[model samples]
Target: MRRSAEPDPSGEQAPHWWQRAVFYQVYVRSFADSDGDGVGDLEGIRSRLGYLELLGVDALWLTPFFRSPMADHGYDVADPRAVDPLFGDLAAFDRLVTDAHAHGIKVTIDVVPNHTSDQHAWFQEALAAAPGSRERARYLFRDGDQPPNNWVSVFGGPAWTRVPDGQWYLHLFTPQQPDLNWDNSEVRADLVETLRFWLDRGVDGFRIDVAHGMAKPAGLPDMPEYLRSVTGAQAHGVDDPRFDNDEVHEVHRLIRKVADEYPDTMAVGEIWVQTDTQFAKYVRQDELHLGFNFALVDADFDADAVRRAIDLSLEAVSRSAAPPTWTLSNHDVVRHVTRYGGSELGARRARAMALVQLALPGVVYLYNGEELGLPNVELPDWALQDPLWERSGHTDRGRDGARVPLPWEGTEPPFAFSEGTNTWLPIPPEWAGLTVERQLEDPDSMLSLYRQALELRKTHAGFSGTDIEWYGAPPGCFAYRRKGGGLICALNTSGAPVPLPPGEILLSSGPIPTTDLPPETAVWLI
Candidate 1:
């Protein structure tokens, strides 16, 4: 693919690197551990820059490592500017950025603007102050007898938590993550300063957490009955007071203003709005540069479902002329390998889907450990750490399974992730054949396929386009050709093999000894 360039400050064309860049999401605590404390840290990530550069990703998004109480891992941040001692100090973060940039890689960190750790000074002060005091005004605190309106937490239970003073505060996720009042000028200004602090320190950009949140509707009305359940709310849309509020756009516009000051820096939102029009609002010209359209992530492995997701995502981003982004897995969801089918069959589908995702235009985000074909590990009840486990009374199991530490090397439990024979979450003994050391020696390995696909996506003229043209295919299969670049990507999700398109095969998820695309296989052709 040709490099994407945009106009710079002096009217000179410069590489708008992020437009077609591949971003790898690094869940910090599970990536690597240099201190052998059973937790991954900055120095460990800095030590792995060569691996990332060789893997061929243009940038990496690190999950929150800011100072926190670890209530929701690092999401419950106590200090937005300070790095937690658990992940190393701010100086360690600087070293990681410097070394990463030296290796020609960009660094983007997570910004949790919708809420702050309950232990954060602001939240703590809000707790200490009177009901309507200035300190309490920065957060949503309601003094009522019936606990405001009925709204449930995304995790579980009521969204409002009562203070000892008989007033209630809003917490969309956990009580530990208090929702911030964006209506307060102080809250907006503080977020701006946080953005500048990291940009000045040489970071590339940010992944805004809960980008559709931070604003609440007037009256805090009760959510409609049909959207009361967690699954129902996610399926229907974000029409509740808890999320996707109209005022959220103003917050994103504020963020875009700060990002514009730094050239080539972009802000991608984790928007969960349902409709194409609603999702487009977050990426408007004056808002975020990109929004994470999770259609592909949420879609089933069926060919028709996959095609629909791609089509909807393209249409949504086209409204604002914003670049579209795609992903198969992230820290918060089940790994795609397991989500597909959870065994050898799942691995095959995942490999095929990787080509499908990388073949599309625009930016792509690859989750850490995804290249190794990592599947979600079924952990014992005693080993689960996600707050949802406790918050849901152990019924939901939470996301801890997907967040297991990466298996870098070795044959046993820790898999060389930590010098100690332990990890924050156990690495199953079955991953012996999937370690990076083992896979690097095998050309047919998942890691090798990813490395090759990413390199091809970067240099192949066949991948240079912003739009795709649909090609008719057999039932249970789909094909699309890149406009302006005659690259063809085809996939077979049917029960049997299908005829291959007439073209020079560039790459395939599985070997094609015959002139046919086998079930659960995808190929890139030119």
Candidate 2:
């Protein structure tokens, strides 16, 4: 296959580098450990830049490293300008950015604009006695005995929690992560200031958390009771007034304004909506540069589901004239390998999924350790740290199973994280054999396949472009073709033998055994 034309990067005609780039998502608490502490820090990430570069990622997305109480694993921000001491200070973060850029890798940090820690000074002052105080207006407060309305929290409980002195405040996650009042102009301006602070510091961009939830319905109405179940619950509902509130556009516009001030700076949003149309709205030219498509994350591994999702996503992006972005897994969800394919066939399926995602037209996001084909580790109730585990009564293990620290060294003593006295989450027993060191030396390992796949993507013309055609196929068989740049790419997502029309094979999950697959086999043909 011919190589794709080099990306245009000359003058005003240059395309954004992120448009054709691959991004690596780093969950800080689980990525690497620098100090003897059990937690992964900026220095730990700094030490792994070369490993990422070797694995073929263009940039890195670090989940929030800001000063927080760790209520939601750093999503509850207390200070946006400073880094949390547990993850190292501002100086350490600056060093990470500097070293990352030196290694040709751009860095984007998670920015939680929708809320702040209850311990934040702004929230503290809001709770204090004051009439029409600026700090009080920073967050929503209800005067009556009841809440401002009856909206439920996304984390399975009442959205409103009462503060001391008898006033109700909104909290979308835990009471610790108090929702900020976007209705307040002061709050919006403050958020813009926070964006500017990070941008001016040499940070590349941001991954806007809960970008859609930043704005709430004016009169928070009662969400349906059926949506409140702890397990098997539809965390988000169409009937819920919180669905794509119009006020959210204003927040995006403000964020866009901030991005415009910096050259080549990008902002990607975590908009967890049902439809592709709703997701597209967040990526308008004047809004966020990219918004994650959650359809793939929630989709079953069947062919029809994957085809429909790709079709809908393509249509949405084409309609909005915006670039698309795909995320298979993140800190909030089950690991892709475990969720899509069972433990027995998980690794094989994961490789095929990577080719599919990488071949799609847009920015590709890779979660840490995904290249190693890491499976979910079962943690006992006593060792789990996610609040969701406790909140949901252990019905769901929350995300701890997937958020364990990355195994860089052999799974022994510090598990390659830190030589510290205690690790935050216990390293799983199997991690010893799946360490990065072991994978690097093995020729047929998932890590090696990932490197080759990314190199192929960077050099293949068939992998680039926005035009795509979803081909009809059998059950459990997903196929798609991208036609442009003088190349045609097709993929099969089934365990059965798929007859390839007259094209050469570009990539396949594993050796073809008897022209039949066990399960979760993927093939790419040109």
Candidate 3:
């Protein structure tokens, strides 16, 4: 069994601010472009603080804006403390943080501790030094005729890349991102410094990228035969040698130590462990403050699948008494709208899921454009930029579709996301109907639904609880109520309409044609 963190001198542990807050994920480059450079930047985010406040999110989790070569779109960090010129400078980030605070929104940024860009000074020095030099100690390098092991890259290909010195280094994602050796004291200390650098700048928290990574298994071993071929969503299930090792807990503890130094700072990890016991380990009292449970993100639109995901997620976090985190879509995967079935039906189902998600008792992370009910775009081959595209020899179209720039206020390509006609990823012309400007004017648009739900979540007494109670419903529907509050949430995925539980209707995902709930619809009641 696990216990909560030690209580304060007052003898009661006050809930952290993030416990009940909704975090909006801003994939920096695709969010907004202030300079018409065809890419979004920190200044662009600072310009949009008002919109986020209006949308009612309590915090903003900005993806990597750290100095990087952009091989992995900022995941391959070259300098963890410096702001990438592509985004802005240190002064710009400080302004964004200060302004966001003025709007009552906490700001959290991504930290990629598992690896650094190959262009980093350390990697450059390692390349020039002898195989056994001190510079080589910072990363995972071993002399080998073959790759150090049979492990496969998450982006598709051998995980090891050989150098002219006849030594191979491990890069689990792309060659540009070399995995750091957590066993190296210097590497661990540098990560601590990185955390303090941003915390000292007043960041409210961090979204730790690949929190389950960093600690590699002993002897640089090959993965078991059965797990080698697993990739993508299924990869989390098998015990791949690449991630989720037992030693990873020590790395998280180091992060937590630094986070505790700053008042009200938090650490939420991007964990993908599937088993309840394994997942719970990352959020234990001494480890990450919270860990993302991706079961719901992987769930389909079916009622049973959604219910199972919810139940499993709750169980996983209950062990540590940590608040569970939920998200339907992110920059890495296919958007939930497209995953639910794509088109009008997909939008309807996505809206229903939002009600289901927001009604639950924990933190919610809404990916940008999700509130607009955005679906994945089918970009031409030339438009694909995800490393997976080239790494997979183009067989996998990659995540570029889900990362298309948001449609803000225009009727054509770029959709005013950039001043020029081009965006990093093109916004489809058909999205004119889904622009934020258009949605704001419509009383019944997806944006409207989210705004109303967020307002209610912030003010309604019915949302005041930490647990939920399941209710009996029809064959393809499920209902649950906040354990302490009287709020009730019901969803119907059946072929026909079903009777609603007796209560006042607070909101519905779609228009109710009668006194009953329609298929692919959800409702909140009190």
Residue-level lDDT tens digits of model 2 in 8-114 = 55545666788878999999988998888899999999998999989989999999988999888898999988899999988898899999999999999898988
Overall lDDT per candidate, in order of appearance:
0.91, 0.79, 0.90
**What's the lDDT for residue 78 in model 3?**
94
RMSD to true structure for each model, in Å: 2.8, 3.9, 3.0
Positional deviation of 468 in candidate 1, in angstroms?
0.7
For residue 206, give model 3's deviation from the true position in Å: 0.6
Quality of model 1 by C-alpha lDDT: 0.91
TM-scores of the candidates are 0.97, 0.94, 0.97
- Residue lDDT tens for model 3, 361-401: 99999999999999999999999999989988888888899
**What TM-score, to 2 decimals, does candidate 2 have?**
0.94
Backbone clash pairs for candidate 1 read 1-460
Tens digits of per-residue lDDT for model 1, 313-418: 9999887858889999999899999999989999999999999999999999999999999999999999999988888877889899999999988788688788
